[model samples]
Target: MIETYVDERDYKLLERDRYTFFVLKRIMGGECKLLLSDHERLILCFTGHPFPVWIWTADDAAEEEMEKAYQLAKENKLLTGEYHFNIKYSLAEYFIRRAAEEGLELKIITNMFAYDCLEPVRPDTESDGGIHCCEMKDLEELVDFMDRFHKELSIDQKDISGYREDAEEFIRSGNMYLWKDEQGHNVASCKYAPDGDMASINLVFTRPEFRRRHYAENLVYQVTMKAKEAGYVPMLYTDADYVASNACYEKIGYVLRGKLCTIG
Candidate 1:
């Protein structure tokens, strides 16, 4: 995939904040192609290894532009397209619906808490799961849980492993939380990327069997707790399309600063 991934330095330069926010990661497998249609920039990032396909736009483009890119990918056998934007800061759903009509799957990520954004969250009537600080010893469980998570999310196993390796290294660089169940099986987790005065939360994932179980809530609870205790503002970036994740972040208390249109 990497071999075919079209190198787009200008796109990265424009959407760097998305990478800074964890809303977008560079395509590491297969190849990427960038399409320029009149005024809008369309990026087609596809890995033939059954990985999730991603479509990004700098902003709202002419409908024909997106359609053209969509048609090209459809011709090339790519089916997934993700649109990221924040509810509080993004353009409404008209474009997202259009993407759907074209058969592109959309996923959005947002801040965990958005409504009354405050530190020290209020607990919800959550599941019976606990969050633990994970060490390298838990690598096997982490990989297993991630495998199931990808399956549930319809992501390719190969893509998850490529990411899991980097995730382990990133988690090791900070305080990592591993949410586990009564039997001590890890269910959810988050990694805090510490920078100067802020620690951006990245890679918040829960196992498929644990979805809607509030494992993500509780795990985020611990993640925010530790971040607050360390005296840094905890923050996260969402692609802004996955409304469910955005809702989860809002329920958790993450405030939306703005929307980012990742051109990856």
Candidate 2:
């Protein structure tokens, strides 16, 4: 059932509620609404405003018209877009291309749109390493942790940082787990997505001093367990060729459901 709600805050209110696969449209913290699977108005309420080219969602197969609409909307200073594409028509590349041609900033997220990705209830006991899981529950500590991680990885740029709101949001609404070293510092960290029934692992980072120690395996196993306990399936999306992460996902029992290619 597709419904649309007018208030942005109201739309995201379900972030902690419902479990349906859905999409949300929040225009600069003003109007918000929920969208059902087939372009239904799950709950759409307009803040009584549509002066902007409010693109709640679009169909990729209707590319030509969609692009034209996007161009018109953009030129008129009314272009905000939300897209939902599965493996069948995964528009990661399409969105990247359109964003460039239309001068829009786009973020692409890929998930288990092709397969029912599952992880072992726990790690293989026969495996040499063990598991470690710790939740940051604290935002300050998370930022500090990221700072140290960036330094350890030699990731320069003073302005280069992860999303502050995302970290805080995850700490409150999601689960944050880390693989620990003997000294108890995190060797790797994976913050699950805020969604209830699905897990999207992000910020998977390993320190230079701790690379290739099966830290990913430990961290992934720990995070997956948390998801299981929460009654949600644990999953992740990463650079397809991130050898360590890809191997870790396989080691923990995730199948290659499909491939995601992004232009930007």
Candidate 3:
């Protein structure tokens, strides 16, 4: 059965698979709107963000557990409407098949990558720009970049009106960075969200005019290095169909770990 949170015991179960169920750490620590779990499968939904509902199942989860998980999701309106789902790779096929069987459609699938190396394989590529932490003055520009980042990928932006707050939080946390060109133009930007020992590098985007110049790879490498310095392993998820972005992360020593099925 699904429940909000029983007690610290719930977190203990998650700690058993810390690395595999990385994002749960954030939900457990942050403002998780609703957390439904049966000790083997978990679902985390946000309260004030447009992010998707994240679902995870233990590797040894039983079929019954999976069914209960799916039922919980459906009952919460997570399976229909404009809501998106970020489902664990191991359960992707099950959910996809189930959705289809139930007359639901899940369109996109993404690959999750984790840095496998002890250190970044620094690209030899040089840039006339330097990376720096985002500042208060950069808020407006960062919001614009965030907009372009989502739009370029055809991502849903119905909740974009809330990006200003998101940008502020990112900057205030000192987790967001931007690469400024020789003339001091913001050419690329990236941010990391730490969850336990893993730091998720996301919202990475380089302007179109800066493409093919290795700006993205270089910027991401710097971010990875920062995360490494802070004693956290770097990880990210990229669109499976985005060849160039996937290749860029691969170049930075990020290997394919698993995937997430994104359904909207």
Q: Tell me the lDDT of model 3 at 123.
A: 82
lDDT tens readout by residue for model 2, 1-264: 322324444445434322222222323244443222223222222222312112333323456544443343345333355332322123344455677776777554332221224656344542234444344545665666566655653322233244455466566664675666677665666766635466655567766677767676667667666676678766555555557667667777776654433221
Candidate 3 least-lDDT 10 residues: 109-118
Worst 10 residues of 2 by lDDT: 44-53
Per-residue lDDT of candidate 3, residues 16-94 (tens digit): 5554456655666666777666554565554433666777667777777677777877887777666667666656667
lDDT of 1 by residue, 45-152 (tens): 544454334455455556565556556555664444432332221322433565577675444433323122356555675668577887788876766666665565
Tell me the whole-model lDDT of each prediction, alpha carbons only: 0.56, 0.48, 0.74
Candidate 2: regions farther than 4 A off: 1-60, 69-73, 76-116, 121-141, 147-169, 194-196, 258-261
lDDT of 1: 0.56
